[model samples]
Target: MKFVGPLIALMLAATPLRAEIDITEVTSPDGINAWLVEEQSIPFVALELRFKGGASLDLPGKRGATNLMVGLLEEGAGDLDARAFAEKAESLAASFDFDVGDDAVSISARFLTENKDEALALLRDAITQPRFDQAAIERVKAQIVSVIRSDAQDPDTIVGAEFDRMLFGDHPYGSAIEGSEDSVAALTQEDLVEAYKGALARDRVYVGAAGDISAEELAALLDKLLSDLPETGTPQPADIEVTTDAGVTVVPFDVPQSVAIFGHEGIARDDPDFFAAYVLNEILGGGGFEARLMEEVREKRGLTYGVYSYLVPKDQAALYLGRVSSANNRIAEAIEVIRDEWTKMAENGVTQDELDSAKTYLTGAYPLRFDGNGPIANILVGMQMDDLPIDYVNTRNAQVEAITLDDIKRVAARVLKPEALRFVVVGQPEGLES
Candidate 1:
């Protein structure tokens, strides 16, 4: 035990560290803005672009249109069909990925310095002039429908869906990112085009670039890439309260083990006590083997293989959530233990030793995240999305270090409400009932 810290320090020091990132805010000639980190070490560049509204822009009945549109972005564009577009990208050794989540549609592009111009042009065409061909649209729609059908039969998926419905009611946040089969099947080519425009407009865009590029060069590239997008998007989703009352919601499935998802309302990313709460969460459940939940639920009583909790701060609402799985007869006991730990954490707080260990691990593990261009660019964009300061990377460790036992106690009392926890259990647990 005495040698643990020193061994960890040595291992961390042995790993190569990237140089301090100097991020530059660049404004394109067309008034579009992006964050740029100029790293000349590599002969390639990675760009991450995000449109803020994402699938939330889907109108009342068009829940899955944004997801389908994003999938078709790279399928075919301009004069290139699907096969030709893929072949062109392969010849230049450029890679483009487009994905849609609840809050954003993300485009990640990697290209060699020599082929940057051609690569950017191809990407621009994909984004601005996607054909939305009939064949490609049907093909992608079938694929999405297949996934939705498969999820309907999954226990975890059912629990998550029911949990969201309980929390948000009829809000867009309650719906699946890939809309249900009925909603998706009714969508048409016109709906895809409309969602495409509404979801990827310039007003909601955020950009980050890293690798062999200069701020001036990135500025021009940003314009060429984003200038053609619509100037504004549809209205953003309004913030809604997470309205889940405290209770057990049992969704019966005939499985040998029961899966449970439990949580209550959470703090936002920019909340003043977020760091303290972060450390407190680490002590409660986020610390793997070192966490109270894992120690008490998995190691002490052997209730389940693992247990964990985390902060889910979304754009509209927040949640403090955790998950565990156990034998049908033992799942109820595991939940009771979890609640006991939750209550204890809020009332008694963590010990000084727990605080110290959490800080050490968090601060030590942070610097290892910036090992490459893609990761750095992604981190920069994420920081911006979270409304962090430009120098957040340098100050993050200090923030962790500043958290005290008293700080954890205060944040724990404010953020954790043991009595408010709601559990959504799936499967026939012998000792539990809704």
Candidate 2:
């Protein structure tokens, strides 16, 4: 009954999607920097701000302070209570989203050109003057606890958690950013205050803005929006060299299908061979139906309904991870096939046909990511956080196109480690053990 699936297929078959974006760098008089893309066709603006050192900046033993504090940013700020703040934003026809990841706290705002100033003022107050009232704290805490409980009951979450614990041990990456129920229950107002000061500061902010704003106006707007924040935040987390034990760790769950997550040490984003590694992963596992893992495990053998792998180049560490799920009776066979494909990719590398296909798919799909001003704004911020140059959007495809078979071979030999893959399977999997 859904036409969306066929409509997308028809549209994609009609033409290759691509974006032609021009980026301009702007700097505030007070020294804040941001990327700007002017699009006068729209009467709205999308702005994205990223503060590095997100939930990872939680003080020792305070696992979810930053996340909880971020949740409270719009609950109330200045004199406005939660409902009043929501009404104010609704009146201005503006939207704000605050999210925290392991590495950064992200704030995204969209507003009409007519309401830019008022919207920015409301957003600024939320960033700098959160109330964190005791009642709001209890409410958001309960919500977070509820989410944690829900996640605890998910088989996929169980697999990922177990895999991370076995791989990263005591590192912050090993745990969920949501914090445990006990941790969330124990957080005090003082802890939230400390987390806010540690995570949202001027020194680590990256910004991107698009639509309805010029360079001069954007530079002024940047200073007005962020100049009063704290000068610095908590220090960044230390680097970690990830290592994985080669085997399976099983957590029994009452399910008919077994869910497995596997990973090993991976290349850093800044490494020279990172582009090659990315392409290699695409050919080996991430290129959807065209990937070798899918061709072998799903097409030829029908071991599972789906399988995939990806490169996770985190700020402080890197991991090559993958996921697969299959009937409990066939889960062991699926794992064996995935491992065999992994070894083949590392030993023999990809063919020229695969390299070309991956390049074309990657290049063609990238432009689809810029489908809207909001996405463009978010992309700009992400590029800034990755330390990519302003021209990366224009040059990224060429980089992918220029990769050759030899580059894939070398990167495959260096980055892929079949023997080091660690898997955590959750289910009552038959013929498989921890």
Candidate 3:
């Protein structure tokens, strides 16, 4: 579908600064609910679906089952084989993507309005009636197993796996989303089917749609696409505490560069202090070259090319985490610098300049993300997942702007624990000991 001048004007007219995004809360006749943003001029629709409790729903001993099932969804479905499914989607000028993450199985579809029915029918088949053919299963399994094998040897992967294990302990979050070698190798067709049933269910689903579709049309589409699924999934995993202790653990690897992942417990997304912590994080590590970690570690000392930190709020737990790579000989100094910065931030808080700059960048960069139909759809779904209000897009910057220096100082002291910081360093660094 071609977008002419009128559509182009409509698209560019709503800048992020204007807070003009009008999001409609849509409820279908069949009782399905979704978020929608109608843009009729585009003559296309972008639909985003998320089945919450994603890989976390993997039953005991079926670690990578959902991951594999997600890959196979588009590989074959209903009467169509893998090749036939690809050909069908291509012929319809539709795009379908299925992916499984730690928290959700995300499916995205884009279809021209002219072929919306056919495209959605194909997508529905892929979701509700995936064939999971043996040949296709083996092919996709081999691909995932290959990645698992590769990740096993990668230093960064090793550090992350060990970090999760150390922090989450026996919780499902500790396990790799793509399952380990033995686990993936042992996953059977029955396991995949069971995983599919447990992961994709009506009660746990969240959806967002953008582009040419209206609320009424989206309601019907929602029911048509997902109504066949079971209403509930199996019991979800329990909430976990980030149990990482203060100190460092060095896994000796024969490499020239050392990779470190460090953090402690983090504030929840809904916490009153979350906005303050968010701004503090941006000043500390999330702002790239302008951030404290970057300026002190990389730009000043040349300890590494990059260093970063972020708040990871999962369904099960929340964490404040960061990563950095440095020459094995210089890693100890880098770790000390990171620890010192953590202490300084926790004790001193950020200045007004830093806070204002963070707010500007955070607010300015947010609206740019809604540049397309698909991204808007995705964002809408994500806001729902985060339990954000319908008018969050308009109000998000105000929340950032309201944070004061005292707020950052108070939240930093509460959330950032310098003594509790744990570093998982992978590589044989000269002067550091665990």
For residues 1-434, could you state the per-residue lDDT of candidate 3 as single tens digits? 23333443454444232246899999988788899988886677889999898888888877889999899999889999999999898778788989988899999998878889999999999999999999999999899989998998899999999999988776779889999888888999998899989999998899999889888899898889999998988767889877667799999998999999999999889888888898999999999799999999999999999999999988889999999999999999999999999999999999999988999999888887888887889999999999999999988888898999999999989999998999999999879888
Q: Point out where model 2 deviates above 4 Å.
A: 1-18
How far is 215's C-alpha from truth in model 3 (Å)? Answer: 0.8
Task: Point out the worst 10-residue segment of candidate 3 by lDDT.
Answer: 9-18
How many residue pairs clash in all the candidates, one count each? 0, 0, 0
Evaluate model 2: give its lDDT: 0.89
lDDT tens per residue, model 1, 1-434? 44533533343233346546688988989998888878776677879998897887789888899999999999999999999999888777777899998889999987778889999999999999999999998999899999999988888888888888889877777889899998888989999999988898998888888888899999998888888889988889899887566679899998898999999999999999999989999999998799999999999999999999999998888999999999999999999999999999999999998999899999989988986667777888888888898888888999999998889988999988987999999999887888
- Model 3 RMSD in Å is 2.9
Residue pairs in clash, model 1: none
Q: What is the lDDT of residue 207 in candidate 3?
A: 96
lDDT tens digits, residue span 162-207, model 2: 8877766777887999999999999999999999999999999999
**Residue 258 lDDT, candidate 1, scale 0-100:** 90
Predict model 3's lDDT versus the native.
Answer: 0.89
Worst 10 residues of 2 by lDDT: 8-17
Model 3 earns a TM-score of 0.96
